[model samples]
Target chain A: MRDTYQEQLDELASSLAGMCDDVARAMRNATRSLLDADLQLAEQVISEDMKIDDVRASAEHQAFGLLALQAPVATDLRVVIAAIHGAGDIERMGDLALHVAQAARRRHPQSVVPDEIKPYFTEMGTVGVALAEKAGRVIRSRDLEAAVELEADDDAMDDLHKHMFTVLMDSNWTHGVSAAVDVALLARFYERYADHAVAVARRIVYVVTGQMPGPLAV
Target chain B: MRDTYQEQLDELASSLAGMCDDVARAMRNATRSLLDADLQLAEQVISEDMKIDDVRASAEHQAFGLLALQAPVATDLRVVIAAIHGAGDIERMGDLALHVAQAARRRHPQSVVPDEIKPYFTEMGTVGVALAEKAGRVIRSRDLEAAVELEADDDAMDDLHKHMFTVLMDSNWTHGVSAAVDVALLARFYERYADHAVAVARRIVYVVTGQMPGPLAV
Candidate 1:
């Protein structure tokens, strides 16, 4: 019975890791759609959100079942709890991608952000993809060192977010109120995405090291 | 052994509830100081934040200990997780209050907001205080009904936040760019405080119902 349960748990973890990859792809596609003003791609990201939600629910159910039936302890308990928390984080990331997609739909053919701001969006997209990939790696390997590095990556995203705001405040951009609102909301979505990624990293650190990193360390 | 663990859990819950009260008071005091331009009161709020942080840490440690030692299942496990999430939310709420205090200090004797916008600030303060208070009640009672109603209050806050932005966009309040930045940040702080409060309410619902509320319900 113990061996069977262990096999089922491993299968559940593999399924969840696959879902994380899809979520990361959805985020990258959503960001690309926003930057390139691709309404069809944005709509694709928005419509596929239900699949992310379904996957999250299934992952959560598996985690809960493991906890209830197997009565996992110590490291096993952490793994199950982390899976549950990570699934929620990935779901929220999907919602953020949908937000970007909705913004794309609202702007239609033209990007709300001008050409100059493209680099920041690109950097943010890269960070989002990296964070998602790292989350999967940590889940599979329980790699504490990689998790620690992911925290720094989250901080880099924060710095980029601040830079995005500075650009919004600069006199160079004259898109006026709509542009400002779009930038503010976009910054919010990106910041929140990074925050959730940090949360997943934190859970990984806790699972491996049995301690949460200091805020400044992240 | 079971009885001893249950008693310890009860004690931990009581301590967490007390911590919530302190958090609620801190938020109210901080926002009142901001509205009234009371620098001394603002400083007091800042000073008390460390105490809130300490209590939050203790509550989290106690919850983790309960989970590790007792190996609680179902409702008991939910309560422990809910407490951890709740403490984190309260800590963030305290941080937002401190942000309001810092903004107040920046304004000093003169208010950043014009007289015409005082009504908006007043409404925000009133809503902010009510939200904090409701969080305290929910923490104490674990009342899902009250938690559901609290989301409606947050909707009212969202409406006020939107109105604030519309007012800022109007040419009549022309207080220069710096003041505009200050007002925008102030609006964001209040809006985010309400958001955290809604999160706390959502956690309460999760603890009671064993499922997350739908987006529309929130």
Candidate 2:
């Protein structure tokens, strides 16, 4: 019985890692749709988001089952609890990706990134996906070192977000208000996506360190 | 022993309600600061946000402690777990309130919402605070009827959000890009604040009804 319970805990961790992988895939496709203005790809990313949601639901169900049946104690309990919340963070990351895809779909054929801000968003998309993949690795391994490093990885996205604002505020901002609004919202979606990734890493850190959740991510 | 555990559960619920009250106050003050350009009020709101964070911390700490001490099963376990996530949502709502105030402070003497959008934001602010207050009552009472009503209350904010966007997209939009950006972000802050309030209600319903969280709030 004890071995079975331990196996269930392992299963929960793998399930969470699987959810993170789905989010990473969504982020990649969202950035692709944005960069390429491919409405079809955008739709694919949007439709695939339900898969992530389903994974989250199952992961949570498993976590709750463990809590109820195994009545996990100490570190065991913390892992189950953290996985539940961490899966939630990853699921929301997918939703943010869907929002990014929807943005691409809304202005189909007209890329959300205008000529001037294209490179900035391209870099943000790249960084967002990379960070998400890193988050996935950290989720599965509970690599405390990499988990701690995730915050620094997020700094690139933060810098890009600020740079996007700088471009917006620049007097040379030739993009019309409409484009500016799109970029602003898009930058926020990516920035928030990165923040949630870091939040997931923080959750892992909490589980590993047996500490409370760190300061709320910005 | 059972009585002590029950009292501890009650304490957690009351603590969450306290955090909700604090968030509501922050939303009201944030709106006031934006409309009035009262730097002092904005500063006060910003500084007071930490208090909400502290409340969330203690609330989560209590939840974690209860989980470990009581080893609560089924409904008892769910309540403890939901409180952990619910406190997290409430804390983020406080952060959103701070962002609203920070927007006000960023402009200092100048209000974030321009004259044209003032009425819209005014309506949003009213709706935001009302929903938050309703969220508080729902948290404490777990009033299923009122909880269901909260969704309709959020619809008002959503309409206002869309109306604000229509104004932004109007061809005759005379507000320069800078002002338009400010108004766009401010509108979103209010809209998101309303969404979080409804999310909080959904969480309480989850606890009471044994339902998993409903469809994503946004």
TM-score of every candidate's chain A: 0.94, 0.96
Docking class of 1: acceptable
Error of 1 at B141 (Å): 1.8
lDDT for each residue of candidate 1 in B83-158, tens digit (9 for 90 to 100): 7767777777777778777878778897767667767877887887788788778877888889998889998888
Q: For residues A1-218, write the lDDT of model 1, one tens digit per residue.
A: 98988886787677667766877888899899989999999999988988888888788778767766777777777777677767877778888878888888888898967788878888888898888878777777777888788878888889998888787767775666556667666776787777777778788888777676774321
Could you tell me which 10 consecutive residues in candidate 1 chain B have the lowest summed lDDT? B173-182
Local accuracy of candidate 2 as per-residue lDDT tens digits, B1-218: 99999999989989988888898899889988999999999999999998998998899789878877787887788788878888888888899889999999999887777786788877998898898888888878989889889899999999999888888888888877888788888888888888878888887788788895568654
- Candidate 1's displacement at residue B185, Å, is 4.9
Error of 2 at A173 (Å): 1.5
